[model samples]
Target chain A: MVVAVAEESRGADHARPWIDQAKSDYWQLIDTEHRLEDLYNLVNVPQAIWIDEKGTIVRPPETAGSTDHFRRMDLKTRTLLPKDQEERLAARQAYVDAVRAWVTSGKHALSANAVRANLPRITPEMAESRARFRLGVWLRANGRAAEGDRQMAEASRLYPDSWSMWRQAADLDEVGKASSPAFWKRVQALGDKPYYPPPKF
Target chain B: MTKILTPTAEHDVAARDGLWMSPADAERVTGWTLKPEGMCRAEACVPLPASAVGTNEVDLAAFWARLGGPVIASDERDVWALGAPADERNATLEGLAAPDFTLPDVNGVPRSLSQLRGKKVFLATWASW
Candidate 1:
């Protein structure tokens, strides 16, 4: 189950062409309201959860095959250096191997206790930020764009970790700010912190 | 009229004195209904504080906070968002049940997580951005 967390209809429409090109057989859904953020505490794209036959969450959200290597890539050419590309591919391959092993024999599934331990802690400020984000989306949809923008800014201020919340407002229109100079600035701001914390395998 | 935003829906109802809505509107805004004993949804009921209940309206902020949820209102007081508590949202983690959601596929057809029951799911989220 692959879901595109595009908070607005225009964003979803923009992805339609590429989704159509994929020609994949799996379920591809669109979440225009960003429901997964509130429901699962997802903070970034390419995050994944593993569910078993009985609907139990065998694994909590984790960065699935994504790395921060792009930050070091050449922006003008939009390409990673060969060595970095190799490292990125190997990391992604390892994640894919784990997924395959788990799907094949349920070999890598975490125990329920482990799953609980892996779940993200939901703080009061994070919850309030989500509420503010919702209100911002509503305000934007209801002809109050400036108020909505302010609401979203406050939401980002309340929970700085949620880039998903930040990006929705920053990239509300066509040209995306997901990879703008501002985004890179924020990334560079994380001097000692890892951008994508490695999954606990 | 005050607009209350829930996870699933947006409700416009008459409000007074800080998010007090009629019992019927409260139920509509939130799934929980105000009863003689307390506010209830499904089989769960939490007794409301006396001050939270008025002659004809329930104090939404008070009752929501009582349920462990958080309530936030716009500066102008025209819009509010009632958020589910961390406890309720994380219940799926503690209980080991994956939260089920329904979203539209690329073709605009609605699909639900429960529909994929009886199979292993690698639920992944991506962004067009």
Candidate 2:
């Protein structure tokens, strides 16, 4: 089964014929808008759900195509230096390699025990943090900029070491829609942390 | 003993808190009815606040708030979130079955999900946003 994640803003006008071609080629095409709800089931982009012929999901959500961009040696070798950049780069590389291994092996490739061994168990607090981050996204989409920032801040607080959370906060701050110097400063502070630098700017 | 109240899909209450939905809206959007006294729509049962459930009305605020939804208010023309509230649900999307909708396509042609059932339906949605 081939699942195509399309941007919600552009429906199937651009994707219909290609999907049709895939169908003619004997592929079962399931197209969906890359929605936050999908993220709830699967995190990261280019994710795929391998459903068996009976329609049962054989594989739970996992990141599909592409390697992590931050892991390249070129990025690590770049000139303008932050002191903790190397460590961050190494961690990113590890994450990328892990994802690559998972993709190549599918479920059998990586034993369930091994997968569980590497994964950080989702605690209630962590789950709540993820929910808050989603709420932030929903609020931003609904035009509640300030509320979104507040929710993002809560998420950052709950998961202070998460680069994704910090990066999201920084992105919202940089957008300047919720213009507050203090908020931007908080974003910068999150970047200054050794393990989790704020995403570039 | 506190009786656990369940909100079914049949209760047609306006979701004042922007979380619990009216039966009509839920059915229209999700192709499921809120019933079973616990937000039961089809096979799903979402437990709700007992005090809020009534024969004709649902306490939209209490119900949706429990589901991590904050009630939104609208001015004459625009609606906005009331405040920042933490979400309790998973950020991941639920793999619920998509309800069949029979709406007009862009050219004013009506289409239904039943018409496309046997074939692999590549459904996509668009908004002007």
Candidate 3:
């Protein structure tokens, strides 16, 4: 099954279009508050976590954006975004091919130990940041907007490398905010670097 | 400022900031009231350090720790999480049984992860930005 966690504070309302267009045959979840982000330590978009039938996490969370979306990005779309289209498309296509091999292989794919080795390590700093992020979400949901914003800012400060965390809470009701600007600048700074670590095939 | 009065102390505090508050509000939040001696809840009372209390605000970091709760704040010292002692974050990673959560579906019905326990789940998080 598929759980489409819409990383929007506004809940499912913010993620309706993508879901409607997909016409997916699997379960689609709307993670309006980003519980999965905090739960699974999502640092960016298009990350997926695979759970086996016995409730075992054979594959941990990793960048899993669709290769088709990038493959079909026409000239108009290419200029609209800041990306090295050729390089990115190659990496994404390679990733798509690898995941297909793993998923289609199923029980014969890899041993539990091999998949476990691919999981990302949660450092002390990231752990604390995750806690603070979760708290920020909880506080915002519990009628503490100002406090929640402060916590969200802390989460960003503690883990500045995560675009997902920063952009998720960016775009304030007030225009010209710091969050959006910071996120954009970082993306520009990471011109050729791999924003996401290599996923486990 | 929240006005709170308990059997032993009475004061006001900015309850939303998690910074300083009256002894009563502190007790309201953590169930531990401030008294002439220290913080107390129900029958048990613990003596608070004289340095812990300030002219107006109490040291929440020290106080939260004394209650045996794990206190985590953002790098700015503005936001804090003070509920679970260890956060049990490692448990989620170690066990891998997708953490339980509830969110509104397309039709606005609240759906939980527990409902899909018996099945293999492919969870993916997306964004507009």
Candidate No. with top lDDT: 1
lDDT string, candidate 1, A95-142, tens digits = 999989898888779987898888898887888888888888888877
Worst 10 residues of 1 chain B by lDDT: B86-95
Cα lDDT of model 2 by residue, A1-201, tens digit: 222443221234544655455454322222222232222323333443333322323344443433333322242444324544556566556644643444455423323344333232334455455555655655566577787778768866876544445554655556432224453454446443332222110
Compose the digit string of candidate 3's lDDT tens values, residues B1-129: 543221112344465454565565566656677777677768877676877776655665567666544566544444455533323455557665656777767777677767777666677777765
Clashes of 3: 1
Candidate 1 local lDDT, B75-111, one digit each (tens)? 7998999987877887756788888888788778888
- Candidate 2 versus truth, CA RMSD in Å, comes to 10.5
TM-score of each: 0.93, 0.44, 0.64
- Native contacts present in candidate 1, fraction: 0.71
| DockQ per candidate | 0.67, 0.11, 0.29
Residue-level lDDT tens digits of model 3 in A1-201 = 667777776556556787799888766666655566666667888888777666677777788754323322343544423465666677778865765655566632446677557655555566556556666765666577777777777777877777677776664323334235454466557766666666645
Better of 2 and 3 by DockQ: 3
Instruction: List the candidate numbers ranked by lDDT, top first.
Output: 1, 3, 2
- Report the C-alpha displacement of residue A198, candidate 1, in angstroms: 2.1
Candidate 1: clashing residue pairs, number: 0
lDDT scores of the candidates, listed in order: 0.82, 0.41, 0.62
Error of model 3, residue A101, in angstroms: 4.4
